[model samples]
Target: MEKAAEFYTLEKGILALKDQIDALAETDDLDKKDRIAALRSEIEKEWARIVPQLTTVNIVQIARHPKRPYTLDYIAFLFQDFMEMHGDRRFADDPAIVAGLAFYKGRTVAVIGHQKGRTTRARIDRNFGQANPEGYRKALRVMLEAEKFGFPVITLIDTPGAYPGIGAEERGQAEAIAFNLKTISILKTPIINVVIGEGGSGGGLGIGFGDQTLMLEHSFYSVISPEGCAAILWKDQNAFEQAAENLGIRAATLLGFGIVDKIIPEPPGGAHIDPEQTFKNVDKHLYQALKKFEGKPVDELLDERYKKIRKLGVFEER
Candidate 1:
């Protein structure tokens, strides 16, 4: 994981000011109290000026911040009565991908997401949010069950990529992801996908197909992570900044491409800075998205989904 200091070098001065504000908050001196207020105003002004000009690589860093909320964090804040389901039946349960049923605003829905655990040991256990074939299979099982009960499926996409270990390939990782793409494309139940963080490669796309796709303002979705792309294309991982810009992985860029149905604004400085507000923003958009498919006919929903998928990458040669 990249150090917060390294990735946030651009905000070094701002962070130092924040540290001063934190110190002032603990004191009861009148002068310190006034200083706190002044610092806050300065911070806000700085954020307004800096956030608008953040480069694509800067946004990528924010998206992958270790402190940023993950799939389980959002579930805790946004859902109720979450009963986690485990295993693919054919193999062991993979901790990297979580799948289950939950109550969203009193409505039952299936939830699936990539889980990159917080602690070092946990991250290793979760394979750094890289799923194997079994993990994808587990997700498919829950999604299919959602369809059986006519419940909507909500998937959170945040992964660097699928596990590329030989064992995963032997178990058919590529085939598992392919199966999910085919099944989700025509599933009878409504589907909503949210890119809360690093939506990278086929790992993100394994459960990414849906009627509506939403992305957090500072998050990124790409065919490959910038570092991986840089290594492959430029033969230098240090060229990630250029790769990020060329990939057009930002939420605003994807929104322009019609790949993202909506961009849920994050709090200033990114989601980790104010996760509660970020959760609320995501909740409001999710509710609105669900309402759009509330009473639509199955045939119409399927037709629209097919058209939407087909419309991607359409271009004309002059």
Candidate 2:
């Protein structure tokens, strides 16, 4: 069984036990009640053992899990009065990227994210979250609007990569990503980036530059996807597991490297298992992050952002 499926099975068993306990709640049997307590303890111990031992491949699988909440899912849960902004103005609207203004905790903010879609038709419509140049442009347009209106920008990243189709290239994909990187780095507004799922390549970075960078516990952020790296180095896509191990792209790894400022803890067995709890965890962190920048000077924010960017790959010789 796949790692994610293993976790799913385990969680399913726990749910079944809980259901049994609920069903027995009206019973007068003391033995049944004691059994319920034992079951709960076992569940807790299982989670404690499993979560810390999750492998890189397991984490990658969880990040790509179909049931994991997407950008729009989060917007619906965390924001209010969301008015979706569409199109790049220069080109057509790209379904792969979603951008807009919304009320987050009663504060107006711009929200941008990759939408991988849920149903098969929806996934096709979103191109599996592989954005194009126009998508990046649309995101940039929203960021600019956020800057003008002095609204903080929050981006949720989840993409395998930018679309690699010939049409995407013909439309100046690389240039579009580069422009976003350049513009967002110096944008005179607070920006928060969260790697909610697969943070892959320049696609993730296109709207990923921000004052605060965060990743979900099971999410992975990488310059290249494991499959891509395996194909390049070993000429075998099946070696992706090995590639994942070597990439050091897990939230804990990235946090240690200072690549991600914070790691939002996921519920046991990953976000797919308990999405409500996952949303609450993300909300808590996001609330704190927004508060951190409130009333701060724009010049100070820019200076700190510049320093953060400059420090990314800097290291001293051993």
- For each predicted model, how many residue pairs clash, with residues at least 3 apart or on different chains? 0, 0
Which segments of model 2 are wrong by more than 4 Å?
A: 1-42
lDDT of 2 by residue, 81-113 (tens): 999999999979999999999999888999999
lDDT of 1: 0.91
Stretches > 4 Å off in candidate 1:
1-4, 13-41
Q: Quick one: how many clashes does candidate 1 have?
A: 0
Give the winner by TM-score. Answer: 1
Q: How accurate is candidate 2 locally (lDDT)?
A: 0.90
- Against the hidden reference, what TM-scores do the models get? 0.92, 0.91
What tens-digit string does per-residue lDDT give for candidate 1 at 200-311? 8899999987899999999999999898999999999889889989999988888988899999998766788668889999999999999998668989999999999899
Model 1 quality (TM-score): 0.92
How displaced is residue 166 in candidate 2, in Å? Answer: 0.7
